[model samples]
Target: MSLAVGAVSSSKNMGFDESKDSEEKSHVSESSKNLPPPSPTPTEEALREGEKYNRQMSETSLYATEEEEDDEERKIELGPQCTLKEQLEKDKDDESLRRWKEQLLGSVDLNSVGETLEPDVKILSLSILSPDRPELLLRIPEAGNPKGLWFTLKEGSRYSLKFSFKVSNNIVSGLKYTNTVWKTGVKVDSTKEMLGTFSPQAEPYTHEMPEETTPSGIFARGSYSAKTKFVDDDNQSYLSINYTFDIKKDWPSTS
Candidate 1:
């Protein structure tokens, strides 16, 4: 019996089969334990989801930026208009001449000349010069007789000086035919510019010069007056203006 069993064990089928099965099982177990982690798949659905998410985020950020830009544009579009008053308030230190732009916008009695005369006044050639400050050169041709037409600077503690005068019919008021009006504006070094109109509720009429002066003693010490002619108490008038340019300073070395 022992010999027969030994013969069977030595048979090729039994030994070879058993060895192959055992080797296969061992390989499977070892490989399973030592296998690499699963790789991330580039599946169509996952790729599409990622792409959609990125596009949505990009669009959202872009839309937010666009909205901000639009808001800024609107703010820039709706700003205040630049009127004479605004210019005066902003540039308070420029005292070149009496600007009639505000008065010419509407019709009024400029310098109180003859019968409600409304001559067309416009800004002509304007030139500026200065040493430590800027000065103005104005050419106003339509102002009536200017000599002896004294301009009284408004009196006050304020550093600003104002000149105002009225022209009446020579026949009616026995006043001279003063045509032109001339007066020094605020001090050249003043930080404030002349304002055309203060009351916005009313129609734009006279212009008021603002006060802002630096004490440079570059004072306005020249003669200024209006030339004028009157027609009737309520009718026609012609005005011419002239002024002297007198400032004790040399020309500026550079602009």
Candidate 2:
């Protein structure tokens, strides 16, 4: 009986040991399957994923900012809106045309038909050359020799003279006011003479043509006046500008 009881106790202990070992092994296998890979830690994977997302977001934001900057640098104007350079160029063109119109309108310092008027040494000499058109080459004083307008007007005598003038300003309507009379002699009475003067009928200025190397200039008559002589060399001559005149640009520069 003792022996049999000892044997039964040993057998029970062995079975318990085997069952415990099997339970331990099964628990280890289940735990290992639930866990992730060992080489790449779970924390490292989370960190790497976060870094990749941040890099993609940064790249997208950088591209968007660059596009916005490019849009800001360039501006578009659809219609009528002029830029600064364009406005400046237009103003320059207008100023140039105004000066041309003034020059082409002629001056008020000239005498009537077949008369002579004194020339101002200061303002009259400003015109370097007539507004790029057919200009009558006036004889300039060569260093020492100076020839001026020398004409004697007879009392009660009516005459008409033609001269080549320049049109610097294009304002043809106000041609009379723009003109300046520099000199005038003593006035004489011509009450008995039936006088008739041929004023400027149209503008003497021409347009720019294709064959024209330089820009074609304009010219016009401003006014007209009569002369009444009182003295021999001091005869009074009437002077005026003819606003209506003709223009011819098919000519070359004389100077």
Number of the predicted model whose TM-score against the real structure is largest: 1
Model 2, TM vs. native: 0.16
What are the lDDT scores of the predictions, listed in order? Answer: 0.37, 0.33
Reference-based TM-score of each model: 0.18, 0.16
Quote the positional error of residue 140 for candidate 1 in Å: 12
**1-255 per-residue lDDT for model 2 (tens digits):** 999999979988777677787999999999999887779546988999999999999988764332363354334222443322232235455877657534543343222211212211111221112233332433323233223332222222222222232322111121111121212222211221212211221334222211212212332211113321111111112222221111233332335
- Summed over model 1, clashes come to 38
* Candidate 2, position 43, lDDT: 93
Per-residue lDDT for 1-255 in model 1, tens only? Answer: 999988877876555677787999999999998889889889999999999999999988774332373354345332333433333345445443324433423332323333322222222333333233334343444444223423222111133322233322111211122223345542222121322212111121233344433222434444333323322222222233444433222332333
Model 1 ranges off by over 4 Å: 1-142, 152-202, 213-240, 244-255
Q: Model 2 misses residue 166 by how many Å?
A: 2.9
